[model samples]
Each structure stands twice: as C-alpha cells, then as structure tokens.
Target: MELALVLPIFAIVLFALVEFTLLFYARADVVEASRIGARLATMPGITQQNVEAEVKKILPPQLGQGAVIKTEMGKHSGDVVMVAVSIPMTLASPNLLWPVGYNLKGQNLYSETRMIKE
Candidate 1:
C-alpha cells in the first residue's frame, strides 16, 4: 500500500523536474536569439522588422510563433542598440499526471541584449 502511494508522487516530481529543465533550455535559446537580433540591429540601415525576422528565423518553429521582438536604436553612430525577445511557453505537459500550468496557461520568458551601433 505504501509503495503504491509513493510511486505516483515520485513520478510527478520526476516529470516536473524534466519539464522545468526543458523550460530553462527554451529560455536560454530565447536569450541567444535576442543577442543575435541585437547584433543584426547594429548593422547600418537595418530596420526593426528585418531584425525581428532574422531572430525568428534563428528560433525553433514552436518558439518562433509566440516570439516577440522589439528593437530600439539611437539616432547617432556608436549609439546603443537594444533588442528584446519574449517567448511564451507551457510548462505543464498534458501527458503528465498533474497538469500544473503556470499563470493559468503558460509563462512568458524574456531576454534583452544591447550593443553599440557600428
């Protein structure tokens, strides 16, 4: 009886751990994508739309859909260029025993990077 009671709890913990790990990995990818976008934004004559498009191309398809990219550029050369990326991810897997979704449905992971315009 004790074994049966403990097994489900253990399995839930294990699944939760795996799900959190994947969430962190996705967050890291978003950070990298933002950095890539910021680097592109530093290029001369690059539009905000172009930078966002390039960032989307670098991200995985699932992440690309919910991804939002924002860019800010200063008026002068050597000015700061900032790029931010946000991705919404669902932490709870339907296959898991407990569907403990975050913030009702999912959480948004955000990343921002800045560089000087060249």
Candidate 2:
C-alpha cells in the first residue's frame, strides 16, 4: 500500500472525527444553555430578555455566535417553559474526499428544556 494513497484518506478521516467532536460540543453547550434558561424562567418576574441573556451566557462562544435562541413561555397547559437553541454546522474545507461540504445547511444543533415557572 502506497503511503501517498493512504495519507489522504487518513487525513479525511481525521478531519471528519474533529468535525464530529466539535458538533458534539456544540450540542452539549446548547442543551446546557437551554436548561439554564429554563431555570431562569422559573424565577418570579423573570423577563424573557433576562432568560435570553442567561442562555447566551451559558452557551459556548461558537454556539452563541450566529445561533438562534427560542423560548416558549407558558406554551403548555402546565405552564412549562420551553427553550430551544439551534445552530448550523459549517465545514472547514470541501476539497476533502469525504462527505464534508461547505455550509452544510441541514446540519443543526438544538436542545429543548421545559420547566414550570415559579
């Protein structure tokens, strides 16, 4: 097996692994942010803007940037507050021999947390 032929494949695999890890981190951050936001919602006289700020503070820098943060206050009969965070995944390069694509639109990280308001 020629090292030249195998090196590119190895590189692609490594890139894919790194990309997946980043996505995982983003997802965790979003979930944590949602949970934090929901907790804030349970506070008395807590404004939506304050909750939004808390969510942004809890999220990672990459997840916070260009990310959509949504909140549903008393959307359910139980007065459960719902928070959702989403962000699109972008690839570093597209020339690799893998499924990596620049601006992969469908790739999104999201989280939902529900809590009763106090």
Candidate 3:
C-alpha cells in the first residue's frame, strides 16, 4: 500500500530531475553559441549571414530549428559587434507526470554577447 502511495511521487521527481538537467544543458549551449557568434562577428570580412550560420551550427537540431539569431556588424576599430540568440524550449508534457497542474511549456532562453572589432 505504501509503495503505491509513494510511486507516483517518485516518478514525478525523477521526471523533473531529468527535465531540469536537460534544460540547463540547453541553456549552456545557447550561451556558448552566442559567444562564438560574437567572436566571429568581430573578425574582418565576416558577414552577418555567416555569423548566423555559425551560431546555428553550434546549437543542436532542436534548438536550431526555431532559433532567432541577430547580428550587428562593427565598422570601425574598437566598435562592438553584438550577437543575440533566442531559442524557445518546450518542456516535457505534464501528462508525462501525474498531472499535478505544472505547465513549463513554451519557455524561451536567450543569450547575448558583444566583442570589440579587431
């Protein structure tokens, strides 16, 4: 009887742990992608489209599918180039749990980086 009572709770906790771990990993990937994009943006003769492509390549397929990338070019020395990436993340369905009314759907993660022109 006790096993039945605690089983659902244990399952939900396990699901939450895994989901949160994946979420944090995804966030880190986004941060790294933005930094790389910004660094590439700082180089001479690198176009905005190239920066966007590099950022997309760094991200996983899921995140890259709906990623929004913004790049700003720096024309003069010491000017700052900016790269911003926005990725909308979809959490596991509440149905996967015991239906405790938790809605983590449609969470968006954003990262921005700026670097001076060389």
Highest TM-score: give the candidate number.
Answer: 3
Error of 2 at 5 (Å): 2.4
Among all windows of ten consecutive residues in candidate 1, which has the lowest summed lDDT?
A: 91-100
Candidate lDDT values, in order: 0.80, 0.72, 0.84
**Taking the tens digit of each residue's C-alpha lDDT, what string does model 2 give over 62-105?**
56776688887773345878788777665222223336454445
RMSD of each: 2.6, 3.4, 2.4
Worst 10 residues of 3 by lDDT: 89-98
Q: Would you estimate the TM-scores of all the predictions?
A: 0.85, 0.80, 0.87
Regions more than 4 Å wrong, model 3: 91-98
Local accuracy of candidate 3 as per-residue lDDT tens digits, 1-118: 9999999889889988776777789899899999999999999889999999999999988789888998889998789999999887672122243376655566678899999998
- Distance from true location, Cα of 58 in model 3, Å: 1.0
Show the colliding residue pairs in model 2: none
Query: What TM-score number comes out for model 3?
Result: 0.87
The TM-score, computed over Cα atoms with residue i paired to residue i, of candidate 1 is: 0.85
- Candidates sorted by TM-score, descending order? 3, 1, 2
What local lDDT does model 2 show for residue 75? 38
Cα deviation of 21, candidate 3, in Å = 1.0
